[model samples]
Target: MGAVINQFVINISLIFLFMSLTFYVMRTVLPIQRTSPLFVRFWFGVSNGLTAILLTINAIELGEARIDLRLIPIALSATYAGPFGAIVTLGLIFIGRMTIHGMSAPFVDAILMFIVFFLFSLVVSRVLINRVKGYAVYIGFGALLVLIQVTGSVGTGVFFNVFVPYFLMLSLGAWLCYWAAKKLETHLWMFLLHTHRATIDELTGLPNRYRTLEQMNDLEMSGKPWTLLVIDVDHFKQLNDTYGHLAGDAALRHIGQTLERNCPPSGFVGRYGGEEFLLVIEGSEDAKEVAEELVQTVRHTMFECQGEVIPMTISIGAAVAGHESSMVVFERADEALYVAKRSGRDQVRFA
Candidate 1:
């Protein structure tokens, strides 16, 4: 049994090396989807080595596998790097165990563990992170533990011996690790929520004053060339007086949706205040093109309140912020908006 254990450990080590090499090569050569090449390169270099490190630590624990903490890397990989990250990590772990242990109990154990972490990456990360809460993650962890036990029982002794004591130990350890991660994720999410709410308008779901400030600050710090468009709904006060506050609100919501849909991918559109909205267009000089597109989108969008169509038009003032402070840039656009309003309401003006 002692000799068998030693042989298994050696096999596990060799398998880890092979897994790491495979990940590295794939990362280097394959075209990873949606992620930056730099990020792909970084993940490739780190994931396998990290997995090996975790495996090495657990292997040293021998039969006493307190393996729940092993999920930290897998969870991070899946959460930050996405499904590809999870797949790479999962594949390496699976192949590593298969290579070293010759398709025995450890192989089955590895598969069960991989499945649990993979689900964590796939399901837990998507829901938990988006909800901006940690409670979901903790619940997810507890559920995963139960699932692991069931999977363990099913796969037991077909390839590996099923031991009640080991199962109990593994489950308990996993619970502890999961609980810690949940707490950490919850606090992190709370912080993100607070920040998002501060900067985003509730009704229109557009960035408010705070968010615009932040965007400007980011642009200033990065020294990136960009364009700002100040959009003011024409005759908004008159429209409000004629139609009612509720109708006006509905119209505003319609405008927000239209702007969001039509805006460039990198652009940020938000309710600046009242009937005023702002768009920060990145990496584009053709303000005329963007403003024209926005005008068309607004013209085409229909706003219905109480089964009646509320016709609306926007006066757009665009200014390029090239090596200028955000305040200065906004001032330029504001002056342009004033010009647009004075000349005619439903036209684009640039400064």
Candidate 2:
């Protein structure tokens, strides 16, 4: 009885340790959904397969029975990775069993048992069920299979002494795995959400000013043609003074959306600051045509708020990024913007 409890605790501990390692990898190393599928398979399939083999090697003996917790890892693999994972784990487990017991009736029995479990797991993988149902169906089935394997095979004394306690521990171990997986999933989601919020502008729904600067620095070494357009809202202060700040916000959002829709596929637009936007395009054709197109689009777009119409226009300064640093290009564009504003807003100028 004591041996049974000790082995059950050890098996459950090994599984918990593996789950902790997986959680660490997902949180610090891999980007879950963004990670490559092949690498994902290695982590979810091959690693778990090895763990299953390890569990088999640690099988404990009680009277006429030898037992291990290999099925728990197999079920977990199927839950995360589907059919491919199930097959990998079961194959490794069969090899482990063969090495331990040699050619015998138990080896044949293991083969038959694996085939049935593999087919059942395949069905579980294809079903459109939630995580809870998937875990319940697969893990519950594994537990029942383990119970039946020990039923008549063990002596009456071993049955009462070893099997009952191990079964209870197995139930707890399965619940622990489910709980930990759910927690890691929630942490990954929150991490992604926090990252998105940090880099995105809430008001304009575009990349923020800081992200634009980062892109500019990267583009300097990209060896591709680059154009930077500095844009400022014309008479924005006057509009805010006449109507209200709320209308000014609405006007900015309208202009941002219009700029995004009209932007070329290769161009990226972002909020430069209050009443200002920057467009980075991949071309050396002076950026005049694109700038003019944007100017005309915003001019024609009418922004309405609370049944009130607000007139809006923008002045743009375009600069071709030559063999110059990002700072120099920005300075040239800012100077050109001054030129456009000084010569009367709502026009485009080149640096």
Candidate 3:
């Protein structure tokens, strides 16, 4: 009896160890968000398939019956990957059981258990989006054990000896898997937030200079025709001298908001630096028209700061990309911007 209990404990430990290793591989090796849907399905199929096979091979023996924590993988696959994944996992388990146990009473019992588990999983998947719904796996698996006992698949003595211990193991395993998955989710969200912060300007909520350059590089690599518009606020330093830096900041924020809101869908806008903004328009034949529109918008808009009405205008330089690199194109746009400022500020110049 002691040896039987010890074997059960060992089997439970091995099952959880396999589960933990699967999660570790998923966290470290798999690109969870970037993977294709077909690839995701294949991943869940292979991982949970192996888990089912492991459970079958290491099943605890009790008077001509075998018991394993196979439900853990099935429940998790369903909860995390949804119905399609649950179906795949169930099919894998069925194949594993048939290959190992052959056509017999034990095999039939396994099929019955799989059917019950699959249905329960379907119900659980709907609510699994809420973390608290995870406990349903325990109840579902517990009901599976009761079904097995009521159906007389196991003798009365073995049912009493095994049911409680197996249920306890399943409950613990389910909770651990849930905890690990939640932790991984939290870590992924934090990573995304940090990446966003690094690439976005906090004050204006626009893409920062670094992100703009990255986009420019990507656009250049695409080998498509595009345009860059460099805009500078006219008399910005003089305005700062008159109204103070806080008013200058308000002016910058207002300009960023106007450019972002009015820019065409094909265009990207960013705060290039102090009082300067960059706009990228893809596949544009109307670069001059867009530039003129932007200049007019800035010229007409009034910026309010601490009961002072500040009137502002912007000078824009437009350049089209052909055989030149992004940096060269940007430099040409900057030169056109200088020309606009020289020709008199409130207008657009093309290079």
Candidate 4:
């Protein structure tokens, strides 16, 4: 019992190690986001399948009972990745069991037990709604698994010793491994959420001033031709004074969304500062055209709040990149923007 318990603990640790290592590799090394859902599920299924194979290889033979926490991976796979993932794991476990106990009664019994478990799991999956409920169901599953294994194996003398320890350890191991994995996943996603928020404006859903400047600098340092358009809201202070600050914020949001939607495929639009926006177009010579288009777009669009629709306009300043730095280019655009505002509102000026 002592040796069997120790080996089972080792298997449990392996599950955690696999989960952590795989997550690190996918996050840092691969960095995949825009992939098909089916592809992601397939990849997950393969990983779980391999994990079950490893578990089967490390099985502990207590008399006739070949006790291993193989089903734990199947349960977790089903829990997280769904039925396809569990089926893959079960397939791998079948191959593993066949490899170990060829042409034997143990193999036959194990298959029958797995078939029963799989059917029962389908019912469990349908009945349970979330991981919390699923975990509670898992205790029952683990008990049944232990009973099946003990009934088939373990001559009368060692049945009690094997069943109790096996059930307890399997439950503990599965739960601890699952809890640790979820904890790590939560912290990882939370960190990513915070990091994403750092680069985004909460009000407009646009890149913040800091992120915009960073990107502008990167494009400038590349030593390639780019266009920068600086846009200012016409009479924004007047609008803020006429309406409340919340309405002013809503107007900004409306303007940001409009610019984002009309931005060219090769361009990026972001909130440059209060009442101002920046459009950075790389490898294009049509800054004036884009600026005029944006001006027209804003003039025609209406900002509606609290059943009131207000006409909005913008002044744009366009500057083509030269040998100068990003700050110099931005300053030039800013000056041109002032010229547009001075000349007339809703105008595009080139620098």
RMSD in Å for all candidates: 10.5, 5.9, 7.1, 4.3
* Candidate 4 off by > 4 Å: 1-10, 21-43, 58-67, 95-108, 128-130, 157-165, 221-224, 306-308
lDDT of 2: 0.80
TM-score of 1: 0.59
CA shift of 235, model 2, Å: 2.0
Residues 1-351, model 2: lDDT tens digits: 787668877877777777667756656444332123756745766667777777777776665666677777777777776767778778887777788778799788778888889899877766788767777788788777767887888778887766765566667777877787778767776886787788778899988898887788778889787999999999999988988898889888998999999989888899988999988988768478999988988888888887987778999988999999988998999999999999998999999
Q: Which one is best on TM-score?
A: 4
Candidate ordering by lDDT (highest first): 2, 4, 3, 1
In the predicted model 2, the residue pairs found to clash are none
**lDDT (Cα, tens digit) per residue for candidate 1, span 17-49:** 443444334533333322536567356535643
Residue 8 alpha-carbon offset, candidate 1, angstroms: 20
Residue range 1-351, candidate 4, lDDT tens digits: 588767877798778877776555544323222132656546665676777788778876666666677767777766665666666667777887788678698788778877776777677666637775675575567577668666856566676666666677777887787787678767677777787799998999999998899989999889889999999999899989999899899999999999999999989999988999999999756777888999999999988987999989999988888999999999999999999999987999988
Model 1: pairs clashing at backbone N, Cα or C within 3 Å: 11-100, 105-160, 157-160
Which rank order by TM-score, best down to worst?
4, 2, 3, 1
RMSD of 1: 10.5
TM-score of 2: 0.68
Return the lDDT, model 1, position 292.
88
